[model samples]
Target chain A: MADPLVIRGVSIDDTFAEAFPMRGARIILTAVNARWARIAAHTMTGFATSVIGCKCEAAIERELGPEDTPDGRPGVSVLFFTPDSASLQQRLIERVGQTILTCPTTACFDGLPDAPERMPVGKALRVFGDGYQSSKVFGGTRYWRIPVMEGEFLIQEDMGKVKGIGGGNFLILAETAEVALAAAEAAVEAMAGMPGVILPFPGGIVRSGSKVGAKRYKTMIASTNDAYAPTLRPITTSDLPDGVNSVQEIVLDGLDAPSISAAMRAGIDAACRLGVIRITAGNYGGKLGPHHFYLRQIMGQPTA
Target chain B: MTDRITITFDTLPSGGEGLELDGITPDRLLTLSNAEIAKLPVWMGRRSVPLGDIAAIQGELSAHLRFEGDLARAEGVGAGMASGVLDVTGSVGDGAGVAMRGGSLRIGGSAGMRLGAALPGASRGMLGGEIVVTGSVGAEAGAYARRGLIVVRGDVGDSAARGLIAGTLVVFGRVGADAGTGNKRGSIVVLGSTAVPPTYRFACVYRPTVLRVLFGYLRRAYSIPVADRFVAGRWKRYCGDISELGKGELLTWAEA
Candidate 1:
């Protein structure tokens, strides 16, 4: 058997987290004030928790100051992920047109200007102007101005898309449910506002960890992860330790590996508090994914 | 300072009509030796003269060039310029920067008539690049600008932006009469006083996001002075040249 590992008075599992390839885009939403920017961001990122159910995943990466935006307005930066480039473009046009363009005092701009792939979202949305839309170029970039009843809605003509990583995750095991929830919340707070990563979940914690497929239902693509379910410990080959009664899993999506690694290091460090039984990761034995993040190797490093 | 070609007028043209030096940009001059460059022909009235006979040429061959002394009699100073920097210390005669494709032309002094206007026969003017005149410009500035930018720090004479196809013309000082009379799909941003022609109809008073970017660029790139009121204030939009396409706009700064 392999030897065990411990860090800051907690056990560290040797397994790695496996992540798959995904397409990502970064968008900036600016409004007259921070409140409207946040509103547009939240509304656009809603109903987008997982690609399996929603065809995409998204969340607010951070709130930006006026200096960070092109128009000198309070802004918010959001990240989105999908399985491919075409799917990403569809989601961007649909969500931005329905949520951001309709929002008062809100304007959208491309966040990742250096990405190789560019999608023409603003040009597609310009039809809302009904032949009255106009475009102007500034500093070599084109921006579309659509006339609205309240005023004008300005958006960049293109959005930059880049290949990214999705399903980077870690699990927290604790002796009780209360302790596990508290540790997960602390870890989420530590990962908040990370520049290149987004936690596309409610409260940044997922209690319903899923597996690849169901045992009896052949049509189901995924089922409950019984191995980590504390109630299934005595009936199945459970991965939980003897004293563990609760588990909390955190999943992250990022523009690059370094960003996800940096976020994982901070989150794991914060989750290694009192009453925690062990820290581990979810994976498929390195068979399904090309990117593997080894827990022990990551924890030993000083920084990402 | 990779050797800038400096052209100084040690003596003026005998007739004061000056020589025409348009085809000889720094880029073109870099291909020739100093002796070959000095032998290049410059037209004065109906006759051609060697450049060495009229002006003193110094410095190594490079893309940056400077002109000193009075050039108000000189014609076609930067006509059809492709790329690189050309600076003029004194005034330039008519047809300055006509049909300019790309690069920058900065005039420290005023420019005569037909500045950046269309060629005598050709249709378009000031194809793609920037022209910054620190002082005033003569009539018909950017007459047929197709795609480019022109910033005038001082006042402009009559009929500015006439026959405009598409581009931007910004003036920080007063603009003379009959502006945007035949414009189509272009923009005239006036920060100073100007009589709005009767053909242009009032659109609205609003802040344009594109102007914020342009004004910022002017302030940084050319050090053009911009007041805070224009940056944070609203503008009265006017759609002009109803006889033409009527898509062109004349944006005037709205006062409080």
Candidate 2:
């Protein structure tokens, strides 16, 4: 019986964002300093935007303090997600070897130590030492030391994998492109560094949001979301209102449902400001994914 | 409440013919009553005798098994034990923890030869579990061990970690001659100074990140005295047993 809650001048949608299950693994990289740690992390996560083409999606989870790392050095934690554990393992070995191992004074450790499922990434990479690699067991976990040109590179024998949620997304409809960009920035700022979640897109905002299938091409898996396009509003079915002229999206991937919900709540709250016409979510009729984050419910409003 | 069962020697055997007390582990006794445990048979020399004939038994089954008095004639004390804690206040005979699968064995006094070593015909020794010795152990400690950990706070006799196939052996004191000989795969971390065998080829001196996790675990789990210098120091890695797989390593503490 309560009236719909409104923040600033923007209206909150009643739809929910559908999220699919993904296999994820967290890798912790430590370096001599924070600068090299970030360099390795950024290189490892590069080109890993979506599983559609990159075969995996990865992002820097957070910057870890020296005490947080195994070697007591500055470190960065990265979260990688794939459709399954096999693919997750494959991408982990390929990325960690090419980026982390190649970086100066960097060592890789498993971030998800408590996860039951494990993948032998370092075990596979140990061959790079060409029979020179040695392993050490500390506490109970095993780590492999590979002799690199720059001293030695140490990595955990196995990385832990767990089931995570991906493709939790929302769209921002605004009266102008500038307004939409500002709102997206504000939403990203609000949701930055939230635990168990990562905004995979660049700057945590996506401009080219896509629909499930192509309009004309049968082979195309996805096409531009023409319904939200201001230019195509006259030709196609426009989901936008009269004053809405621009739209951008924020896609989220998290370790669980609660994390996505918490992030969405904070992001939507920051986005529901002046010039933003409405806040809506992307979903496939709640049929594809098991997790659904209702916009209004997350904003503390009763669902219709 | 003290849930542990204490067993003290009531009548000490005269000879050193070795007693097979493999069944006296904590996990095996956890289900038995005091009388039932006392009736358990232990092989002495060529004959079997009731455990109560040699030791005074008290308390019911618990997570811990405490043994008092010198057990220097007790061989296979915790062999093949899968779980629980075995605390020995005195020295034990040879093959004390041979072929153990899991659990922890802590010895306060010296141990005889082949501590945590393989059984007579078994391919591997101490497949899983941990053995901690506060006093020096005799020859061939952790020989042919496939997996698990063995920590020696005192000097280790000759041929330590011989034919090791994937496991860890940490010697806080001096490692005797011929240590890590013919080891296929495993790690031998020596904190005290010792002569390296010619078979081991010096690889490099570097700090291993795994030791941080391991040292931290040892410091917290067993309250083992881990020097900050050794925990945070570089180690001289030597790949050895070239006559075998040459995959095993000997990491000697270099500096703080």
Candidate 3:
């Protein structure tokens, strides 16, 4: 069998995917229930779209149960990454202070427990209240309690920062929007709540894809991937086949390489149902992101 | 390696303006680029001055520092120090080392009230740094110290080391009344007899190995004399502040 798997007439590139080292920290936001957890995660991960513009990139890694949380409440784990440790700490302090501290019943914890590098997040955010905050140490971790009018807000003293991989993705091409969306949804649902993997987009789908740079704007680093847009098929170098009409992509970020690959495998298999014309991926010709996930090798091929 | 300066108010001088110690941070100043350091707000009397206004800075790029001065009236020293060291040479004023973390501090003299205590509305104190005071400390020393070390060598005022969590504090002197009031996982070592709060229970009477390490560090780093009796003596372990986590322990030296 060839190294890259070709499924449904689509090429599963055989090249070994490359990944890079990035500073990442997981923030666990515990709220009263799933609703509050979502709120805190959304706010904490907001304005953190890309490291280029926002100085950090973050998303909800997964939803955790009451048993999975430190405080025995429903929570969400957010993965935040930056280029360096100092930037990571500063960004975390800004984001968590604005997001989790203001949210009701939200308590933040470090998700990367084993990483030796520790960044002080709550250590900086504790000054919002000036002098009324308290602290508690449980299970070898110190948590800060910032008093608010509603009650108390708890945050971990130091968050573990580790080298993580970002920008892992796959594409789903289907005959109709329904099929594309369904497949994307299925993929997201399957990967949802999985440890260390986060779908950073709304509903885990990216519709406005991009190429390396804008065609006209020299300063724009990226623009639309018109080559893949079904509408631009007539004028652009459309990669769509004869029957494919719609496409949606799933972008994943993880604490490690294997996690992204595993989640991709699960998501791709679930998306390979009826009306799904093909599956592919997005990469910078294997130049930008250090991690690469070739499709065919991830899924076992049927013997000839 | 820390650039944060720790200024203690040596005295109010009855009618004089409150003393300010703004020149002795070691960490925050080191790590910050010159431009960054120029922006940090330090106080002189009631007016605000850039960090460059007072102290002459030295050292290469670093994120930790030490302060050596009499700071009895210096308020807000290390007030918003994110991560650094602030060693004080003399007694500090109220709110010394307030809201500090990610580094350490060694205070040679006494700290005024609220040493390592939380900021006005903050619930945590000295989030992730070490605060070592060789002399007696005022009330609420190490109050709400979240996850670091706070060492006081002399007698403390009331409510010393209260609301501590997961940090280690060693008091070579007698701890004041109401020590460890709401502590969670902090280990307080009192060299003198201390009245155990109702929340603490006597766990055992044994010598801890960590004390030797602590004493060694004190002697080497701060030049504080480590008495052999206290370092090698048996300690009465009282596992208390259970009202919080039941994880914190108080190790008071037993009568030799």
Best-performing candidate as measured by TM-score:
1
Clash counts for all predictions = 0, 2, 54
Poorest stretch of ten by lDDT in candidate 2 chain A: A133-142
Question: If you assessed candidate 2 against the hidden native complex, which CAPRI class would it receive?
Answer: acceptable
lDDT of 2 by residue, B147-255 (tens): 8899999999999998898878999999999999889988899999788889999989988766766776777778987988987799998887888888888999998
Measured by TM-score, how close is model 3 to the native structure? 0.56
Candidate 3 structure quality by residue, lDDT tens digits, B2-97: 334332222334556664443335544665565566556766667776655554454435655544444566665665465555555666677777
What CA RMSD would you report for each candidate? 3.4, 3.3, 15.0
Tens-place lDDT per residue, model 3, A106-196, is 7788878888988888888888767655454433466666657665577778999888886777888889889889989998888877778
Clashing pairs in 2: A138-B214, A139-B214
Ranking by TM-score: 1, 2, 3
Q: After superposition, how far is residue A194 of candidate 1 from its true place, in Å?
A: 2.6
Tens digits of per-residue lDDT for model 1, B1-256: 3478888876574576566878767667766777777898989877898888878888656788788888887888888888777888888888888888877788888887767778998888888777889889889998988877888888989999999888778998999989888898788999998999998999999887667667766776778778878876799999877889888889999963
Determine the backbone clash count of candidate 2.
Answer: 2
**lDDT winner between candidates 2 and 3:** 2
TM-score of candidate 1's A chain against the true A chain:
0.97
User: Distance from true position, residue A206, model 3, in Å?
Assistant: 0.6
Error of 3 at A234 (Å): 2.2
Show where candidate 2 strays beyond 4 Å.
Answer: A70-73, A134-142, A175-179, B1-20, B30-35, B43-47, B52-73, B89-93, B108-110, B120-124, B243-245
